[model samples]
Target: MTSYDPQKIIDIHAHLHSDLPSDPALRVKALESLLVEQGLVDPAAIDAWIDLYAEEIGPKRGAHVVARAWTDPAFKAKLLADGTAAIREFDYQGHATGHLIAVENTDTVHNVVVCTLCSCYPFSLLGMSPGWYKAAEYRARVVREPRAVLKEFGVALGEEVEIRVWDSTSELRYLVVPQRPEGTDGLDAAALAALVTRNSMIGTDLLKARA
Candidate 1:
């Protein structure tokens, strides 16, 4: 198995330049430069890949699905019953999403997802996973101290509400359908989708009502 330097990874984020032997970000840049110099990788291609996920294919896909489920009762039922098939109705399918299951947030329950082993995620619908989601701290602490983690993310659930944490794997992925915000009764599907944030879909935050 390949081993990574934990210190380098920590240094990259901590920005402790004084204590570190070398700048982690600069080291990564130098490595990328070397790869480009040797024609082992293409910067443009990498940029294109990042752009495709960040803009073209992103949380908007999941938001559209959520909005559709919210507006259509039959679709919602289908989604709740078989998330994989329901999501396929929109033609959103790709890697790490072999068997999709959607957990819904309600008045009494909330759902969140994480990949303990690695960053196994539904990239097709959710786009790139946030850095925080893949962080070691988040992965280690979320399962054992969910309430505290949620509080750190500014989500304060009531004592009576149930918190469900879904551990995603390469074979089975999960999406959280956040509870619809109040005062959005007259909004159309597109409008409703606009209200859905990436964090809400990740269950780190809730949908806020439009002002």
Candidate 2:
């Protein structure tokens, strides 16, 4: 228990290498070399893991949703009215199952998304929510008032553009479906799709067609 205790040295050594091996693949190799891979964790099992790791973690599959809306009007409407069902149509599922709403972003009325009921993100497909987006400040400001929040995010809207704030419920999570910007006339669907970011799809920003 004195200063000579080996535990203190061990702790210091641990902290020294804490930030090492950031790459998961390298970590796996280290684990294998240390002979701790057995009964430790199956590398293949980790590979088999789908997007499950991203739970309420990311943008809630917003990019895919926006791409669909820009290309298919019917699909967009279906998604806006009933996100769960529309997502199922695309063979995607996980979280926010029972109730969901996808707001349509238009030039006149820009939409930004947030979940005040707890970060009910759809990470099974979207990956992970940005730390700033899932923060308490963003949640509170986005709910109490959205236009101001957007301004803070550097998203300025003119007086003619109305800002709509959407609240996310436990049963129903919402994502922003921003409108497609002009000037991308010749670009194909694939190129257009590339322009759709998860944030834009979730109404956090607008998509500028491949220009």
Number of the top-ranking candidate, with TM-score as the measure: 1
Off by over 4 Å in 2: 1-61
lDDT of the candidates, in the order given: 0.88, 0.69
Candidate 1: what lDDT? 0.88
TM-score of each: 0.79, 0.67
Model 2 clash pairs are 57-128, 57-129, 58-128, 58-129, 176-201, 176-202, 176-203
lDDT assessment of candidate 2:
0.69
Range of the 10 consecutive residues with the lowest summed lDDT in candidate 1: 12-21
Model 1 steric clash pairs: none
RMSD (Å) of each candidate, 1 decimal: 5.0, 8.3
Against the correct fold, how does model 1 do in TM-score? 0.79
